[model samples]
Target: MIRGVGSYLPEKVLTNAELAKLVDTSDEWIQQRVGIKERHIAAEGEFTSDLAVAAARKAMAAAGVTADDIDLIIVATTTPDYTFPSAATLVQMKLGMHHGMAFDLQAVCSGFVYAVATADSYLKNGLAKRALVIGAETFSRLLDWTDRGTCVLFGDGAGAVVMDMANDEELAAGRGLLSSALRSDGHHWEKLYVDGGPSTTGKTGFVRMQGAEVFRHAVGKITDVVYSALEQANYTVADLDWFVPHQANKRIIDGAGAKLGLPPEKVVTTVDLHANTSAASVPLALSVAVADGRIKPGDLVMIEAMGGGFTWGASLIRW
Candidate 1:
């Protein structure tokens, strides 16, 4: 069961108007295309681990648990503080946790859902009793500031959830994760990816994307995975109380929602405020909905994301 959730955005704010000064783009164009108003950028020296720690602390507190209670830590990110040690370990250290397994999962924006599935498996198999699942990103560091196309679409933030093993009775009562569907197609990797990597260029690369191609694929893929997950849970679109999708673009979100026949009020979006936080988008939106009382116990929720690497996934949860 998911015990608690939390999210953190950096203090720095980058508005589209401000971005226009750096590249040949304006607020109007960005809004019309991506539906982003402003995004948060990490300050100098701020790392993905730092954001993860802040969000993790709040999640732990909300769950009424402590660092010692966590038996597993999983961080999903495309931007880690280093190529080694993993951001998960750094987050564990910062939280003063020393036990349990800790690692990182990289599936771009679909990372959080992937991590959730992995953690859910561990808990179900009794490998872990409690787990910390976090999606943290410093994507601003990977953007080509001069390329308004990608730079204006990303931001820095983190979001986390505290989950623990739930009994069969709890599952039957719809109190935990129900099902998940994950898919990846490397053939479409070039459609959206980084220009460089440690193994490829020995340097952290800039974000590169074929925006039109991505949009063309996103709606269909997202809709398919969402329905797959719902079917696994023996539920349908009418059963969903909320649809919290990756805050990548308003157009994609709206398109996917329309395809699923979900009403506008059923969708939860935060892209206008935080833009796209990559792996952090899903949990960040989940945290916001829960905090605002839009999500409540026993409510059925669907979470999904599609990002670089052509990775995409969806999960069904009964809050």
Candidate 2:
């Protein structure tokens, strides 16, 4: 079961008007195309690990658990502070924890959903009792400031969830994660990816994407995985209480919601406020809905995302 959830965005707010100053795009064009009005950028020295630790602390507090109570940590991120030590290790150190195993998972925007499934498996298999799953990204560092295509579409933020083994009673009550569906096609990797990487360029790279191509495939791929997850969980669209997809674009969110026959009010959207935080998007949106009392316990929630590598997945949760 997921015991708690939390998130953190940097103090800095980069508005569409501010982005217009850096690139050739304007506020009107941005909002009309992607529905992003502003995004949060990390401070000069703030790293992905910093964002992850802060969010993790809040999730821990909300779960009413401490470092000693958590036996596993999984951080899903594309941007690590360094290439050697994983960001998970860095986060664990900051939390003053030294007893548990920690690692990182990279599936781009689909990372959080992937991490959730992984954590759930470990706990179910008796490898762990409690786990912290975090999706943190300093994506601003990877944006090409001069390119309007990708620069205006990404931001920095983090969100986390605390999960532990669920009791038979809770399972019988239909609580906790029910099912998941994950898929990927590497052939479409070039459509949305960074231009460089440590192994390829000996330096960090900038974000590069074919926006139209991504838009073309987003809705269909997203809905397929979502439907598959719902089927695996023995639920249908009518049983859903909330649809929280990736916060990449409002158009994609709307398309998926409509295709799934979910009402607008049941979809949680934060793209206008936070832009796309990559791996952090779903969890960030989930955090917002929960904080605002839009998502309550016992609700049937569906979360999904599709990102670079053409990776897509969905998870069904009985909150």
Candidate 3:
């Protein structure tokens, strides 16, 4: 069974009022359109690995496991501390975990679902016993503060889950992940992307995006992916107990829910509170919903995300 989830947010809070000083946008404009009021920002000394370690410790504690129990670690993010070492390896070292396969997965906002699905496959195939799946991002490192379009649309945070293997027979009796679906289209990569990179400019660059274009594809693709996940699970839209989607934009979340025949009340939204944490958004939303008791074990949960790589996907889990 995938046992527990936990999250960590940085100490510094970036309010819309403060953002106004950096860009031409107003607090009212941000709230009315994107629903973001404030977001967490990593301190100068903090890095993505720090957030991942904190979240991973919490998840391990909640699951009643230790670092020794984890056989695999998957860190998902678009923001890494460096280009050489994988973020997951950094996290493994921080956790003092020495005996496991560790790597990173980059699927932009859908990274958590991708990591989770990969962990599920590991457990289901008996290749690993316990897996640590983390979605950590320090998006402040990627933004162009001068650009109002993308600057106000992101935050920094991390979320994690600990999954343990379960026998098929036991799973059939309700002890394992039920279903998951993931998809991506590289053709839409330019819709949103960084302006420079290591090979291109010999230095990291800021993010650039077509906000309206992304907004158009986001709602439709999110709804379609959610429906596909449900269909694959042999379930219908009505069967979902909670729709935990990427905390990108308020309009996208609401629009996708409505398009999926789901009521606003059935969706879990944290965009107003957290903005888009890239790969961290979905798990962060899931962590919040579970903490609020809006989601629980034995309930049907659907997670979906759309992001910069123009990558998008969804996962259905019978908790």
In order of listing, the candidates' clash counts read 0, 1, 1
Model 3 root mean square deviation, Cα atoms: 1.2
Q: Write the per-residue lDDT of candidate 2 for residues 172-202, one digit (tens) a residue.
A: 8989999999999999999999888878998
TM-scores for all candidates: the values are 0.99, 0.99, 0.97
Q: Which regions of candidate 2 deviate over 4 angstroms?
A: none
The weakest ten consecutive residues by lDDT in model 2 span: 165-174
| Candidate 1 local lDDT, 135-241, one digit each (tens) | 99999999999998899899999999999977778867868999999999999999999989888999998999999999999999999999999999899999999
| Least well predicted 10-residue stretch by lDDT in candidate 3 | 169-178
Error of 2 at 186 (Å): 0.4
lDDT of 1 at 111: 98
Q: Which residue pairs in candidate 3 collide?
A: 298-319
Candidate 2 vs candidate 3: the TM-score winner is 2
lDDT of 3 at 136: 98
lDDT of each: 0.95, 0.94, 0.88
How large is the C-alpha RMSD of every model relative to the true structure?
Answer: 0.8, 0.7, 1.2
Give candidate 3's TM-score.
Answer: 0.97
Comparing 1 and 3 by TM-score, which wins? 1
